[model samples]
Target: MNIRFLAQSEYFNGLHLKDDIVLEKEYEQGPFTNLPKVRYFLYYLEENIRKEVMPYTDKVDIFNITDCQSESDYLYFIEYVDMLDRTYTFNIIRYNITDHTHTKIISLKDNLKLYPDNKQIKIFILDDSNLIIQRALPKVSENGKLKEFFDFSLILFNFVKNKQIIIEDENLTRNGIEFILPYSDNNCIMKTGYSLFQNNRHANLTKEEAAVESLFVVNISQFISDLQLEQPNLVMNAIDQSYYDTTVINAKLIENFLIYSKFNYENNDENIIFYDIETKEIYTCINKTTTGEYLLKNATVIEDTPYMIMKNSTGTQFFNLISNEIDATYPVEYNVRFVNNNTVISTIVEKNIFGKETEVVCIHKFPIKKVILQEKGEYIGCVTSDKETSYIFLK
Candidate 1:
């Protein structure tokens, strides 16, 4: 088992530093000395443990910090600034590690047309250009006291074209820690499944009571201008509750189609469904082996591939629908890419610790399996995406 050593001593792990999101990334700025004034952390252990203190220089009240676990050396954060009046302004700041400088990339000022008194806000960066901002405001209770409830909304903004798509719904829920599981360039999908968020909040989730999940497909290019209203207008609907209370484990937009894998808690099984958005047709992949236990947190579909990649608990596995089999396993948690259905280039990163020494090596392994795709589905869904045209036949 891999264990992560905590950097928290009696120094920083206190109540005072408990409220902030406290985002950290694996970055080294000038030998960890003379670095910015931000809390640093080391995740996943290694040798040559180093520590240093430096003064943080950027002059901004950082509300939250966002870290992208990528090769980028820059750090992005969000801030709320006061502007003389009762209203406030939100800014997305990008800090460059090379020059020790910061830039306010996006400025969302207070406008009467938009929400002015947004109390809490969270920004998630899909890339250098695409981002989504979620904001929440308070709601007063009937007893003349604060109800501790905040209505939330999601706004998809593209910094490349300066286009913003607003998401407004009566039943909207969001988690502060938001991420994008990208399917393509402009297509992004977000889903909220069941249970009603336990007292209308993202924390403290309760089970036993099942709720149907709603899937929303948003194309950023559709709402860029006012003329694209007739372009499907963001199809939002709940999956048919014919079986049990299903929770969405992963969702995606593949070839303009919706492919999702969800676990049914009632039956203790998992099902992968494919729904075509344009044709309103659906298909399901029947698994011969029992799934739903030991799930992978990530669901990534490779380009020009028929199989969906899953980070299996034991190793990396390719879950193919046509073969109805999971084949070709690699080392667990290894950075791997597929050369074909049968072959994978595994970049194994391992740090070998021998007493007072540690040796890190990256080994490439080729594991091949001869697999083919099955065209016809094991089971085709009678469900329709177009609910208006869906007809119920009395049998």
Candidate 2:
């Protein structure tokens, strides 16, 4: 079995986790000699040996691992600031697994533009070819003050092909965007609305207080095609956001179904909405006392499957979108990561007598095994395991 080792000293037998959303951060200036260096290694479980993949360096400020596997070429992004000019430099590197060499695909210097005082920006590396960036642009007032209504822009830059597509709309400028997801292979769905952050005073706001107004599902490939034909207005004119006028959040697209959850203000409960994108048939569940859970933390659609695992204050249920039935109800302890028809991958917390909790990886089907780590870390490292091979990461 092939396994991707992130760090040394301790071995963690869990699937390597991959995050679709990546936020950029600033690092302290200097030599950073006292900091711990984290390196990447490729472990062959059958032979029980690891080969050095990427050595950690002090110059590189940020490292984003796009893809890493022994069977295929690994892709990663490294960003560092130029000390002389104080400019950010980003580079995409493609490493050949078999040959033990890497190639610099593209390097961008001083291209990242941010708001006043470098507020925050999100960088999404969809693949080695496509890179999406979302940043909040400033809206200056007449008195030269920043306004609350900030304009947002989504830029998709294909560094390999050297093509770019920018989407700047009034809707994004007005309401603002919460998150964006890869709809399928060629499309992406953007959710635009305001959010009421969870606090002790007001945990779950009612619908009248905070509600999502618009959700735009755009076909990136089709939009790009229309732009190529010099018909950019066609894609912009096709956007309709009048149907979903409710408090919707955590929207995910699986197959032909757009599954999401909404809050009921009257009963103070949470409800799940199953929307059929093809037939326009929406099926919403009855109100349940599953409110107060944080957004995006309680609900997730299983990757490469037709099921959505939803956790609430009540319990966790595996809802089948195709059959419109609850396949099985699991305890709230088991956090489902990835699932298919044959295999179920999840993590469960095991506590010892001293009240020390250790998260263990549980592989249910295909080949049942419980993988545990010797050293416990606070961060949730990468996880990816399938029928063929598994590559796990740990601190």
Q: Which window of ten consecutive residues has the lowest lDDT sum in model 2? A: 15-24
Cα-based lDDT for every prediction: 0.42, 0.49
Over 4 Å off in model 1, which ranges?
Answer: 1-76, 79-90, 94-120, 124-133, 137-150, 153-182, 192-212, 226-244, 250-260, 272-294, 297-319, 325-366, 369-395
Judged by lDDT against the true structure, how good is candidate 2? 0.49
**Alpha carbon deviation, residue 383, candidate 2 (Å):** 4.5
Stretches off by above 4 angstroms in model 2 are 1-53, 56-74, 81-88, 92-117, 123-133, 138-149, 154-168, 172-180, 183-185, 188-218, 227-248, 251-258, 264-267, 274-283, 286-291, 294-395
Give lDDT tens digits, candidate 1, residues 1-395.
11112233222221111111122333333211222224443211133133221234222322333332223445565444557676556677776543446667688764422323336565666566656676666554344333332456667677778887665433344322233333345545545433232343222233322233556544545423321232323344544332134555565554545776666555666666766655656656533335444222233233323454666578777665446567456567554532322223333333446534321222222234322211111111111112111111111
Q: Predicted candidate 2: what Cα RMSD to the true structure?
A: 8.0
Error (Å) of candidate 2 at residue 394 is: 11
Q: After superposition, how far is residue 124 of candidate 1 from its true place, in Å?
A: 5.8
